[model samples]
Target chain A: MKQPIGIFDSGVGGLTVYKAIKRAFPAENIIYFGDTARVPYGPKSENTIIEYSIQNARFLLQKDIKILVVACNTSSAVALQELEKLTDIPIIGVIKPGSKLATDSTHNNHIGVIGTEGTIRSEAYNKAIKSILPEAEIFSCACPLFVPLVEEGWLNHPVSRIVAEEYLNFFKDKEIDTLVLGCTHYPLLKSLIDEIMEHKVKLIDSADAIALHLKTLLPVESSTEPVMDRFYVSDNEAKFSQIAEYILGVQPTPIKRVRLYESWFE
Target chain B: MKQPIGIFDSGVGGLTVYKAIKRAFPAENIIYFGDTARVPYGPKSENTIIEYSIQNARFLLQKDIKILVVACNTSSAVALQELEKLTDIPIIGVIKPGSKLATDSTHNNHIGVIGTEGTIRSEAYNKAIKSILPEAEIFSCACPLFVPLVEEGWLNHPVSRIVAEEYLNFFKDKEIDTLVLGCTHYPLLKSLIDEIMEHKVKLIDSADAIALHLKTLLPVESSTEPVMDRFYVSDNEAKFSQIAEYILGVQPTPIKRVRLYESWFE
Candidate 1:
């Protein structure tokens, strides 16, 4: 199938996922959308999050995509099932794969999950980890500042380290062998988080796990054709391009802006 | 004369202005709307900011308000002129009043402004300050992290202090005498910011200036009546009430949740 694979996020955090996808399936054409105008979906109510997520997915579907990946943890945790009902295309979200990977990697039966308020509040990872290992202890904290810190391009800055230490203090008393970067943006802060958590904890980014999971499902011949990547955003194409370069080490070109108004839905 | 005065913010930052209004005109009835579901209007495109502002004003106007205050700086910077045309009621925004106060407060004619990306990029304050004092030097930076830090309720937390220092580093050598708290939420961090600036600079809080300016335009008889204040938000009324209590030292009661979609707009 030549149809492009559609990927969507609240913003540039999903470029990490896009990078992973590109690494695994270099020949697969991709269409990505970052809702930059309305970034940081964590603070919004569930109804608004799901509404915006739906609008984003519809915007991507208009481009004729084969698979749609909900790269935003907020959407994955809260909007995945609703999105499944909206489209017949094969759909996926980061939470399930991330949870599965975290569950598998944990040896001490203690797992820590960190994400935005929306994701942690939904308890998507907590429930997912609990289902696989009923006796496991899942410690979760909503690290809302991480998103802003990452966006500020302060990945290695002392301020980011201070914020990370403050946020990760929740895990100091708990004995956890593994941590899930429940929010996509957290991966960018991996080194700092590693410094704070020390070397004992394994950090699960979920991007690689997700790419591998999708690989097993796609037809063997799907990768035979040369792939092309296109980027789209609701607003601020230049900023998105800059962020993409920071996250993926390559600027996303030919980016177009699309409007996701109520009329787009009805 | 019995109609309530209207105030609208993208979120609780506007409450600073609301508190000022209450202190100055305790007898005047007031209605305030906080778009908590879609806050930090700082990053959204101008068209979206304008559309949302109009919807918020329209929602407030239905209550028969005497004045419409765009308590949000982003809306004030970008949507003020357009809002005046939306209705016959006298419209006011925080930027002009704050700029006027900053101009009046500055001794060396050098001013520094810190706000969300939307506000700083709009140059609303820079232009406003220059119009009255053309030779005034303006230094502006977008502290996008501050809003999230404040929302995380870390006003005086060490993390907030670190972020403030990092963001304010740009002004260290500029030798500005007065600094404007361009975003309303910023007032909550005044003490911490004051500490960072080493108590040398005068902090200009626009809420007080806007309230004082509005006093000149209001009728002398308006304060004779008993005051009644009501709060409304698109979502998370409880959260808004909590923030109001934190910032205003009074929990807003009789807060109603209202939807501001096209249906409400119509």
Candidate 2:
């Protein structure tokens, strides 16, 4: 049996990353977890985020997966190191790949990053981008409202447009050639964001970056059958599936409810 | 020393209730618990909410509180019955008092209630209003964006005004004479909500109603000294205190960090 790759996020926002990964590796089995009961990890404290991230990784690790993916940007920013230290399995996060994409896409060294408060506060993107393009200047904004707006599915709504304009207007005078969609949920607001930026700035979606990164690291398994990807959420399976359908364009099957605090090994 | 009154919510939104209770019983000590780490319980399932509510109640009960108050309307709606079963101390929730206030103020018995998805979905306000005024007509809308907007401190922002109009416009043709601010965080948007309703509808703030309800139920203690109110939050003490100060008009001192799942009694 092929070992399933384990992917987890604070909530369904990570489905974007899941979609990208699936497109890249259609034959590999994937197990996905969303901590919907305690989501929106964006504005939460670092310790709390770290604790939740560890719990999520433990849950995924119990499946005997070959690889682990931290799909949530907040968790990627704050808890990636702790998660890396917890297990011997190869762990990948969204930040470095997206940062690499930003550095490659930008003509000028100047780039803009927008994500949840937690991600921006951690300065993960700023540091990652600066490491690659040593002379790069990163202008990052914590667009806390963006996640909620995206969750509300107001993607093309007038209010979303107004909010996007208000947020993206920060980059107007920055002379940035590329902007990174630092959070997974942000890809849904791409069209609106592009319109707001007047299509001048290249937007780097972390989902695409992480998927491409996985392609280079993992061998492609040859299989003709459709993949049976398992899904789990701490709470609200229906809402998760609904949002998953909206994001992935296919109804996710075999989704189960899980209690992460309950030790899976025992 | 008198036994302190306990109030708990999923997050800082309940500070509105805490402020009201403090104003009503200045001499009585109050203990508030905000489950900030796993907040925005509005979108979670009923079972998860009940589980979280029980955990919160257990934490507060360990402190020997004389009375328990469920400050969150979502909790008040779905978890109150479970919480009432968990404790013998007198329990007060925001629902019944606000329902009574709305029933009393409506001239046409047409009322509109707006709150989180969980609160609006529970139909607690509908049932409560119907029990009192059998002929009451209730129109409820789940204004999920309002809480985030309020938390972002965009109370009077143009985007807030536009969003409010979209939500409150549901009651336009319903001829609702009264509107109930079903969630505790809603009072901060009082002026914006009022304007969206064209100042024609009477808005029932649960904070004031809950305070009045507590007044009739409890005897006033005789004390000239300032009452000491202890605050406990599951996470992000800084954000909680910052928001608390904004809602209460006074900085909350001696706010402690707590782990609700760690079993305080054990």
TM-score on alpha carbons, each prediction: 0.93, 0.97
Evaluate every candidate with DockQ and list the scores: 0.36, 0.42
Worst lDDT window (10 residues) for model 1 chain A?
A257-266
Model 1 residue pairs with clashes: none
Best by lDDT: 2
Instruction: Report the lDDT tens digits of candidate 2 across residue range A1-266.
Output: 67899999989999999998999998999999998888899989999999888888887888899999999999999999999898998999999999999999998898999999999999999999888999999999989899889889899999999998898889879998899999988999998888888888899998999999998889877797766789988899999989999988888989998863321110
The interface root-mean-square deviations, each candidate in sequence, come to 6.6, 7.9
Q: Against the unseen true structure, what C-alpha lDDT does each candidate score?
A: 0.86, 0.89
Q: B1 in model 1: Cα distance from truth in Å?
A: 7.3
Residue B80, candidate 1: C-alpha displacement in angstroms: 1.8
* Candidate 2 chain B: worst-modelled 10 consecutive residues by lDDT: B257-266
The deviation in Å at residue B172 for candidate 2 is 0.6
Candidate 1 lDDT tens digits, B1-266: 57889999999889999999888877788999888877878988887788778878888888899999889999999999889987999999999899999999999999999988889989999999999999999999888888988899988798788788888999999999999999998998999999999999999997998998898888635456666788888777778888889888879888988753321110
**Candidate 1: Cα lDDT at A24:** 79
Weakest 10 consecutive residues, lDDT, candidate 2 chain A? A257-266
Q: What is the DockQ score of candidate 1, to 2 decimals? A: 0.36
